[model samples]
Target chain A: MESERSVVIAPEALDDLIGALRRRGFRVLGPTVRDGAIVYDELDSASELPIGVTDRQEPGSYRLEERDDEARFGYAVGPHSWKRFLFPPRITLWRAKAENGGRKIEEEPPNETQLAFIGVRSCELSAIAIQDRVFIGGKFVDRDYAARRDGAFLLAVNCGEPGANCFCASMDAGPRVRDPYDLALTEMLDGEHRFLVEVGSERGADVLAELPSVPASQSDVASALAVTNDAAARMTKAMPQVDLHALLAGSLEHPRWDDVASRCLSCTNCTLVCPTCFCSSVEDTSDLAGVETARERVWDSCFSLDYSYIHGGSIRASSRSRYRQWLTHKLGTWVDQFGTAGCVGCGRCITWCPVGIDITEEVAALSKQEEKSHAATA
Target chain B: MATATPSELHPVGAFVPLPFRVAERRQDTGDTWTLTLEPEESGFAVEPGQFAMVHVFGVGEVPISVSGPPERPGDPIVLTVRAVGAVSGAICASELGALLGLRGPCGNSWPIAEATAGDVVVVAGGIGLAPLRPVVLHTLAQRDSYGAVSVLYGARTPADLLYTDQLEEWRSTIAVDVTVDAAEPPWKGKVGVVPKLVATAEFRPEAVTAFVCGPEVMMHFTVQALRERGVPDERIMLSLERDMRCGIGLCGHCQLGPTLVCRDGPVYSQADVGALLGVREL
Candidate 1:
């Protein structure tokens, strides 16, 4: 509102920019090279970003590829994002020490750091929005997820280049953010040295005020648009969810599941890599002395036998049923249950799957079956 | 439409490791322990068939049925927990004064309101009786409020009947007909399964509501027994248990068809889950 929140920064402005954020005392969490993938971690400088580097991805495969040109964020999706900052994989629900016959209760603190999640992708924001529906908009709410989500600052990045596994364009979720972000940074790699930014929040405007910036001419904005368009058009994967809820709803006896089950490793890597998957199990443990104790909510997966157990037996006993449950919930019942598509089409599950079980390919197969069955009846 | 009203859903939760003064611990088997917890101050009188998510502090919580009657007001309720997971394993090792976290008395309970006038047959198997024990106790307390009542229970063996002393108490009053898959040398009661007993029992199905809880196999046969005896699906109730990680209903782990066992039920009419039974491995 004060003039503009937009602060156009060149590639060289990254280091000083990180220093400014650090001086302001924000624990800046952003992307960095880790184990052959871009992962979010504590960063102090632009050097942490994989400059002149990009990633190659596919179902069941992820590899690093050398970038022909240098750009901090010249690529699309990464394995890490704001999710880890908000919904931790494991968290302590209760802590207690010995007191007489019962354990005395202990407490956990709320977010201790002023978190600034940098380099958030548009699709990731969509995932976050979906998670909001799950954690904050239900009959019962999750206090911890709310605390982490509410006070944190966001810095979303529109896609400048599509990864081989990316299908956000097909899902109509990304490349350019339709909405939801404090500030959206559009990387203009075509420029000799720079990135163009658009601020979407008042907080973003104030943050931009302290950074060295100048008004971008119309050409800069136009070039930024071109880069995003190229990324959207170059996307390697495509998924159609048109009437997916109905398709899945009607697919109770779909035989394509048997095909998928035969190859699925039941490794749960897909759920682990997925940003929105949030099934968790509660754990309670005690010290041998019986003096202290704790309860924790750790991530759980449907692939595990223990995930579904009653006094008698597991309901979804077969791997086929487990797979069917997960697929149906993700694409079908989720809409009836949560009123939103459970997937963001970011394609992390594709690249991380060890057996290369592609959700897009699976949906396409199901859609194909629907057409075939319709033809058979007609 | 978010199933989980996240921020407010888990309204009061924080696993606090506290020494749960183990008021008592009864070893039900090599892998099962019936524990009675006394809330540090004055334990809440949880309803019949209600459960407490028992936490071993650090391990996590599991829904354990309260086996004791709530009429005593603040008296601790009994929990017959089999050592199937981490929490159960720790509770099996816990002694009096061991600390633990308590989450709730959640999920829909037995319809104590509707089971009036008509006779009620409470059938349970193995540790499944723990969840049904409260209903049994409440029925006995207000004996005049309901009609003729009876309890039929079975277990893997003679020793598996949880709360044996309580079984004797109910038996001494009327009949706590206990059965087993296979009777032992010392076995004295009926040497058959629960559903078999139901088939031969003298209860009138037309004037009764049979609440059955057991291994799906046992319940499967029991449902058949009631149906053959002319009991309508609506008159027969069952406790449908599944993997209920987040009892608040956000996690899709326990969804069965259009219902979530965590929220819509741990209790359901036969008609509610019959479609699920039709699907293989549902």
Candidate 2:
């Protein structure tokens, strides 16, 4: 099955693959150059892919740089993730209308658009799986998320060129596409621009049978493995290997929180760009004459002052507390809630933050604080 | 892909509200109101500490405890709300026969069934009495099952007290002690905080299962009083309040430490959440 599953295709064959998906009633979505940054958008052809593109990312900064070769999927993740497609930023939950004597309530039907997500990174796959735990894996399923997830097709791309902030190697989430993807692609640029395609599922095999492809030679598979291995080696940032949950649980009063709060804007950029941050709030609005009403679920951040609002006031009124809540929940308490860490080491939180508060750096600081406190007690 | 069946598409998975009509409405105080709601189709039975997400049509929803007696499932669902926010204000203003939306009977309930043959101490502060009202009533209904039962209630003032008539009537069967933070003329009961009343409550600390609900500070002091009285941490229970959008626990607003207060608890033993309560602004 290993030899039968591996195949190689020319760069142009990507067009036929997209065409095949579209013919099968899937709206193909992939990375494209949008507003000077690579973003996921509807794709009609493979030419729309971000070819000859790479990204340079640092804390609080992101920029698109021209690559020396035309290799698609040559960049780390951007601000936009597949979360926007799965758990939309805003969706109508239900609608209500004033009827005779009583109100008539109607729930919004589950979204049924079949989506073929192309170029899904390994970390992004982990993010999706984490959200799957959050929405559908719990006692109550988010029907919308379940429907969208059940019908979607995943086309994972193994990372070949990791960015400055890439740390999926440390989080054990990626650089290699080992998650449950329909088809995994590794772009090779040794003399010829081609993709080594590995069929990950029966559906992936069916799709490959329709496309013009050949069995992958020993060299082809080796080169593909080397691409991801090189990316792992190129990673510069990493989360320190420690019991992060205990570190955070003991550092609730650590002054490092105040330090981050001073630099933190509480702008919610990290949460908004986060692929697995699932916090949301519901809003109810009515039309004029108070006849028709709709309830909308919108993406909400814990950093927002009102996110923790109760009857009297917001429980976490201070910026320090709110920042602490976001970080502690993402890296610490998230494991207890969903059996996994919320952060997938995607680095979007660090790259997109306005103040450039690097989560990795903060955790390192917290670790150092923990060591210092232990030494003092000793 | 297969489409969802009718049962799979049920509103329970989508957080959709079921229609309920306000069968009875009574203003408990100047700002608080107790509403009895009847389901238009099927009714939901709730345990003593369980709560419901009461919705006011165009207005949003808020988590309110089931204030009605748990023994009376045939009776309409009772919710006592204070006009503190927009949603609660709309619920408080709901008139009799007004249609509203409801979801849940969510979160864990008080362990009254487990406290049989032991004393029970029910403590409430201000509007906090609404959630614990069921515990006191449940104890009264099964009077012989428990050794001793007491209800210690406190409010900002006599004007802010809820269920005044019910408090006097409950005195006939159980020990009901009411206190005020401060009082004006004609006020003639205890004049200290509610935790002080815990000292004179008629319950043996060794055999007592204490249920407490109130403002965070008040609950903190009350739990301290219970601890000083030798009540085991596991036996002291409290209901928590937090911002919640989905009462089913997906919204993540009601998270306290590792627990989603909406799912893991609105009611928790002191031994479970004591350290978290001590964390400032947690």
Candidate 3:
């Protein structure tokens, strides 16, 4: 690998980077204000980015408002992540039509289109890596996810302001980017509005050659580092430092599960917002004439009672079992299965939860029970 | 390791089903039938205890175990399906010469090699016997290699029993015993749960490696009976049933605790999964 290089670019020149990527046949996708919050979509220029906008996020709450300072990428993550683009919500697996003497099965090819994602946060990058373990890291890779992932280019943005519900620092994922990216930009607005760009790959260097930028000075790098450090200190929530995998696994019958289950609506909002949740179910539908059939895979959540259904009845009958399964699987057994924790600590699940149920609080409750049990033994 | 073998495991991109012709169909019970399928093209290989995702044209796909012996040069793959649900009912209703789609031989199987030098015991209840048919045939074919072979089968009633001729034929070489839960007159056999037959079966607890397939409740009781008789947990094997969506680890439908019953197992030793089975609503 080549040594890293840095550059200084004014806020207006950011459009030139977008133009360079578009010239190279990349459909650049960036965050834009939509439906009361910033969501990712196709972007033609930097004007489409959520500039001068910040989000107010808390447990079971998310709202966007205007900001006095015009800082690009000022907000934390929204409800959606990049998973929607890689692993689509619904995919057509195959189609079968009644042929001459027998029905012929036809396979549907995967979407191998090229894409470039802009303004990816550190937590989102960790989420993508976790999903890669589930879909692409195994012996049998998911062809659709692998193709899309292999063809895409990532543009990371280091966070300067951690949102109210953000806890990526505790998860060891956030406030700063660590994953491999084509290019990384840290927006520094301390008296001077300029971005400290770090070229992470050869592709990033090639694109940097096309843009008009000056070599960043040592002070510029210091300013960028300070911005991320302040953001980490400002994080409102902190995940408890405990052996989460062991604690949750042993707390299967803990009473705190019942308390949270009563408040949970099982609407699946938390799973839908979670960047790493990848459970899906297949649906086979026939045409009105009943000559052709289509098999499709669609996203499904564990909160649904039918997700674990068998022939006679559903395996997880109560909301209590379902919630317990989700939390334990995401935080506990996931480490054993995938060699990593499922949650990226993006706090999207907390902000998007309708009933304000916080995973951090639930984990803390379980940890407290364990401490009491240990004390009794002592 | 009930997970698929390297050769039989297909990447997700190969989700397309292949058309196979139903060469023969035999009805064993009112709601159950055994269908023998010949793939339109050759080169299809399926291992014993493995299953296939069988698709009926307009209905849907359901995971059915390959009931036949390991594929021979020109033999067909056999599947014993019972009409327990809508998808299975449609599959059982298909006529001969009809074409159905198949996509598997996925998941792991019973360890036949381990039983070669030791006592081989097989327990099948109701339709669960379909998956274990291969193990029985394989052990009997190499009867001289194993110490002793015993097959204990049970069904709801005498009429509900499957493979009558095969059972009688197997008795000539292997120890085959049949029982019914509620039998009607003239029929004189044991009338109790399937695990009770384990007491009368000829095998030493130290040398026996049992293979079981049945309802979850029956497997639980049978495993208990085996453990009480001093059979180690690792030597006792059983196949589990769940709502398997994707016959791979991608879909989370068939997960039981830390194990993905599709990829990690449908077959597991009692020592490996005894604690997992104890967890409620897992």
Candidate maximizing lDDT = 2
Question: Judged by DockQ, which candidate is best?
Answer: 2
For model 1, how does the per-residue alpha-carbon lDDT over B88-127 read when each residue is reduced to its tens digit?
A: 7887788876655565555677887798878888889887
lDDT (tens digit, per residue) of candidate 2 on B57-123: 7779889998983344445788898998888999989888998888887899999998999999999
Which of the two candidates, 1 or 2, achieves a greater lDDT against the reference?
2
Residue pairs in steric clash, candidate 2? Answer: none
| lDDT score for residue B56 of model 1 | 63
Ranking by lDDT: 2, 3, 1
Q: After superposition, how far is residue B282 of candidate 2 from its true place, in Å?
A: 1.1
Q: Which ten residues in a row have the lowest lDDT in candidate 2 chain A?
A: A1-10
| Candidate 3 pairs with clashing backbones | B2-B108
Q: Residue-wise lDDT of candidate 2 within A107-216, one digit each (tens)? A: 88776668899999999999999999999898888988887787689998898888887788889999887779899899999868888998888888888888898889
What does candidate 1's lDDT look like per residue over A1-378, in tens digits?
Answer: 112345577777667666766776678888888888888999988899888888888778778888888878876677665777788888886567655544557556555556777788878888888889888777767767776776466778889878888888887788788656767778886746677778887767667666777877677777878888988889878886568888877777889988998998888887887888877776667788756766677878878777887655777777788888777777777776677877888898888888888898988889899999999999
Q: Mind giving the per-residue lDDT tens digits that candidate 3 earns over B67-159? A: 994366346889999998888998898888988888776788888887778998899899999999999889888888888899998899989
Please report, as a residue range, the 10-residue window in candidate 3 chain B with the lowest summed lDDT.
B1-10
Residues A1-378 of candidate 3: C-alpha lDDT, one tens digit per residue:
122389888888779989998998778888999989899999999998999999999899999989889999899999879998888889888888887876766767665446799999999999999999999898768877776677477899999978888999999998899988888899998988999888887888888888888888888888998989999999978789998988987998899989999999999999888999999888899999878899998899999988988778988888998999899999987887778989988999999999889999999999998899889999
Off by over 4 Å in 3: A1-4, B1-12, B69-75
